[model samples]
Target: MVAAALSAETTRAALFLAATVGNVLGALVNYALGRFAIRFEDRRWFPVSPLARQKAETLFARYGQPVLLFSWLPIVGDPLTLAAGLLRTPLTVFLAYVTIGKAGRYAALLWLMPS
Candidate 1:
């Protein structure tokens, strides 16, 4: 928000792009964690509790892929990204929706911020 709000005219668009890209990359990390980390979930030291994982899985199962549009949300967003991986969402589809949602969010922020 600060970066979008305070960026100079020459760099504002670049900043916005950077922010969106960074956020999407972070989500990718989360997705990778979900995809690659699930084997350890059966172990005792895994981060998320079983109930939390179940809830995330249930939400993903119920809503399907379009639900990823909400991945720009605050609390629910990160979990949904991870859930996408855990549930075996196709990579291309995941990137398309996630990029759309994340870029849209940054675009909105840039539009709303005062010049």
Candidate 2:
């Protein structure tokens, strides 16, 4: 979606700003979902095993802020952000990492695509 938008006749500044804003919004939504909507106790919805959550918690504890860098990975990325939010990870730190990760990911995608 972002790539398509950037490729349009829109001004470069506008495209860049849109992409950045979209990425941040996506991360924030993921964080909110994990923090409020999904419940660990609610097996029907979350369905993730206790062991998995424990592992994720341990990874987050060990990695601290850098874990946010992996927030782009398929399957794992969204959950990681959500877990970070649920764990009460500092908002500033989380946003910083998420922004960097998302920016880098989009930048790479933009770079790789044919002009």
Candidate 3:
């Protein structure tokens, strides 16, 4: 990012694209992992209780989209994407929200840098 900020305008744009694409790809991976975890959801050994599951589903249904806008958060961000996948958030929706959040954060940081 510092390199980009210190480089030409085109370089900054390229760096922004690289950062956004890479971050989004990572979010996709986490989402995929969450999707994979679902295979074990119904197993007797699964950790979540039925009531807990229902409550989680309810919360996600109600607030998931809005919450996803904050998926740019550091440590907390990854789990939000994972939860979105576990709750069966559509791919397009996940991408849109995750991209917006992540890209917005990067954009802000880049903007904050000296030109």
- The candidate 1 region of ten consecutive residues with least summed lDDT is 1-10
Off by over 4 Å in 2: 2-7, 11-13, 40-55
lDDT of 2 at 50: 52
Every model's TM-score: 0.83, 0.73, 0.74
lDDT tens string, model 3, 1-115?
6775686656777888998899999888868866787577567964444555555456567786767787787656766776787878899999999999888988898889887
- Lowest lDDT block of 10, candidate 2: 40-49
Flag the better candidate by lDDT, 1 or 3: 1
Candidate 1 Cα errors over 4 Å, as ranges: 7-10, 42-51
Candidate 1's residue-wise lDDT over 1-115, tens digit each?
6653675645667877888899899888878878998777777865456676677678889989988888898767877888888988999999989999999998888888788
Backbone clashes counted, model 1? 0
What is candidate 2's lDDT per residue for 1-115, written digit by digit as tens?
A: 5556556867545665678778788878767766776655456665344555566677788888798898777666766777787788788888999888877877776666566
Residue 22 deviation, candidate 2, in Å? 1.9
Instruction: Assess each prediction's global lDDT (C-alpha) against the native.
Output: 0.81, 0.72, 0.76
Per-residue lDDT value at 21 in model 1: 91
